[model samples]
Target: MPSSTSRRTVIKTGAVFLALGVTSCTGVPAPSPSSPSTSTPSAGDGPSAAFTFGTASQPLGLDPALSSDVESYRITRQILEGLVGVDQTTGKPTPLLATEWTESDEGRSYTFKLRSGVIFHDGTPFNADAVCANFNRWFAFPAALRQQAPGSSFKGVFKAHSDEASLSIFKSCTAVSADTVRIDLTQRFTAFLQALTLPAFAMASPAALAAGTADVLNQVRGGQPLSAFATNPVGTGPFSLGTWDDASVTLVSNKDYWGERGQIATINFLTYDHPQTRLQALLDGKIDGFDAVTVGNFDQLVKRGMQIVQRDPFSVMYVGINQEVPVLQDVKVRQAIEMAIDKDTLIRKFFIDNTAQASQFVPPKISGFNNEAPSLGHDPAKAKTYLEESGYNGEELKFYYPLNATRPYLPTPEKVYAEISRQLTAVGLNIKPVPVDWSDGYLQKVQSPGDHALHLLGWNGAYADADNFVGPLFGEKNGEFGYQDPQVFSKINRARSMPQGQERDEQYHTINVQIAASVPAVPIAFPISALALSDRVANYPASPVLNEVFTKVQLKP
Candidate 1:
């Protein structure tokens, strides 16, 4: 929903100021995109001209359909091509595989005109039939496959699959003609086009899927679950997988690509879990660029003449509250937790300059932001009173926080946890710290049903839509929050089908207020994340949603 150019806003304190000019028409059909430079450079696609990027962790899986982590999406983005692309300046939907599209049937049906002559990396035709095949695959995913791939983006967007077809938004996929395809939905989703920009919806080669046994999760890489086809996905993108090992993941440019190849012939995403290690790697000439530049490294990068690009605040770091926990079921206890947090203090101490305290999950830049949403501001006296009113005895609540990991939203997890824990304890709440290493399945542990009562997690907005923020996180009852509010769920489901206008905006405003008042989770801060690069790079496409494709990187000669 947010797009930032050269415009900057001044922050009074340690944060870099930013001005947000959000576009409301996120689902408008964009004109046919000019394919990137189709001509190859004098040097062919090879590892000698590789540009290495430092990543905090290894990707969970190569298949975008199964993984939602930034690292995995980073790699898959180059290899996979979706029907829609994101407009860098507007954060709106643009044509990718499909040249143009039209919505009919009161937004319940969409027809796409397939781009002619496009072929998958496996030499299979990308036609109307191919489109249906991809759609059918996602719709018919077995119960076992769904269980193994818990982070299914399709389920998040479409609502369900064959297991619960009655509840699914998807109704049918039809090959209207050789170059035309149509999709029918049970309900109208206002952000349907915007949600298609997610990497998880990218197309994969049908031939390769059958040959590689895509359904079988029989392999493991870097302690991540994966299928054979996931290890060797085939897509009609600008790059193809080269090699993945203990050192790094390499990609070779697709010589047969239809668009601009730029100057980069090969790309490398190297693992450097720590911010200091990443900074050291860049200084040592081991890598060209890195993401998640923390407060500690920002000044150093500026002083050393490294290029640091700051992205607009497009993510929310929150204190997750699971309603399943008996103690947290009490509304007073939840209110106490929210009131106890001093968001201003956390932002000043741990976040970059210009980071704003968030009162709701939707970013302020988004259209649905409720200016009147009520916040239980920091009041230790009030929090103590709420706690006392709830119950006399204190029940220990396990707070989960990832260790040795740095995210765009949560820069320093350990430090942030310490401060938050202290504040909760100050309010007479019993808090137990559950520090888990990020690489040791911290996300799975906290996201799934477990002993964690409170967890430090956040949602990074993927496209320019309010549903992109609230639907996947709180649309329905899920393991992460274990929050099941039938009224809120019904309201959101109704809002999803409404056409864009004042009524839709008002509906979201009301929803945000409802979510905030109920206190399913405490919205803490909207972090302003940045990236650091070496002098060798002239330009890098730093996106707020992390929708960066390495082919856009331009190097200084």
Candidate 2:
């Protein structure tokens, strides 16, 4: 995550466009398009008083363990704190609830020294025992429960790979002392630290757990949250829940906060599913800020004198190809589809300013982005040749996409899909659009084998690591996207085990290059994301990780 100083540097250089080579992806010289520029508020400007933010969607729930989508994550971070936090500038693990930690036994064991004098929002003491209890509960959550509630994104990282003992890497969490907890792993997993930063690993109040707040079994069977957990979340952050419902979420400041208290007394996150409505709310001064600003509205917002903060590229919009489907199973067919779409034209036609066409899975800031990787060019003739070689006989590929959900990476899903569908048909492949409401587990359906042939999805780095992208998308054979390429899988594993250095980076580069050749998915673009703020808002934290902290935010008098 970039700090305020570095963020300002990026703004001055228009680095979002330069870093990803946004305009140069096609290897064809085209006139440079105008991109979104950034500026720092002089502290004398922006909204005054409590911050009220409107978003395009609502969180499924506030429990960190049960929320996976970005809307949920944005709210969850305010209510929970993990054992580890991220350094704003470096995007590396730093101490949070846990003051310090040490690794031993060749990285198989980790002991964390908990910060003292901390208490949950419910007034329960936070101790090593609480940490152990939270860990045990996560490990004990039924795998069946995970299927019913796809929000448990931690399943990929925590659940055993197989029934075989050796295949699983998780061991146990034990309280070594009143202020220390030790976690044991079955192996030396290099991405363990990165994994800890995920919301699933966040520490919740043990008292709430004891009260049966997170009833995973009941939640799985009934599709209803245990009201205690859902309605009244308990965490050790700088805010406590004020009110929560489907329409709006309100958080009040924690006056007795252990860390610095937030400047604003309250934050109201109102759900505005319509992009235009949400933007209008900000424009009309009904709200102070919002994210996922409507496309083609930057100039309008700038004209309105709004304070816009654009993040450096840290996400990838892509098409997920399910290999289990017959036609898609053909590597040539997959490559043909990948080569058919013109990403450059799509960006210009549909995307907002500064979004770059992606050639590989991870973004430029991530460790493994290969500058020398081959670009998947838009060539209709080449696409046709590949389709002919594969002997595809006009089978209708079920191309699934979501409706009513606007994400930072894929803001206009329907339009983007339409463009891609048009390109695929022009290349002689039959295309069928299967549109579903995004809230109806659209992403899960695509990731599930045989349910989809081609689907549109995207990822913003959960933590600023390459492993965060590869491990979730392609680690296990049954991982997300259901993409099975033996060479790609093997190379990814080899890359995951190596430490962060030249050797690890080289291995990752090799793996990315291999994935491109495999055509498991079409890497679309690294989107330039922004947040709209009112004139009187100041020090509104702009995080590269998109995990904005609200404690330091201020409002003019």
RMSD of each candidate relative to the true structure: 3.9, 8.4
Question: How does residue 464 of candidate 2 score in lDDT?
Answer: 62
The local lDDT score (0 to 100) that residue 337 gets in candidate 2 is 88
lDDT of 1: 0.83
Worst 10 residues of 1 by lDDT: 10-19
**Candidate 1, clashing residue pairs?**
1-464, 14-353, 15-353, 15-354, 16-353, 36-259, 36-260, 37-260
Candidate 2: clashing pairs of residues: 46-535, 46-536, 46-537, 47-536, 47-537
388-418: candidate 1 lDDT, tens digit per residue: 8896378999999998788899988999999
* Top candidate (lDDT): 1
Query: Residues 1-557, candidate 2, lDDT per residue (tens digit)?
Result: 22244334222222442233211111111111121111223334332347799877767667778667788788878888888776554555666787667788887888887878889988999998899888777776666666655567555664352334365567888999889889988866676766777776788898886675575434421133333575567888878889977689898877556666646778899988777787889989889888876556565775666777777777888988877777777888988988898999988876666678888887886767799877769999999999989969998888999888888888878888999999999999888899987766675676655557788998887776677777677766663456766777667766765666789889889888887888778988998777888877865776656667677676776
Off by over 4 Å in 2: 1-49, 158-165, 217-228
Worst 10 residues of 2 by lDDT: 22-31
Model 2, clash count? Answer: 5
Candidate 1's C-alpha runs over 4 A off are: 1-29, 33-48
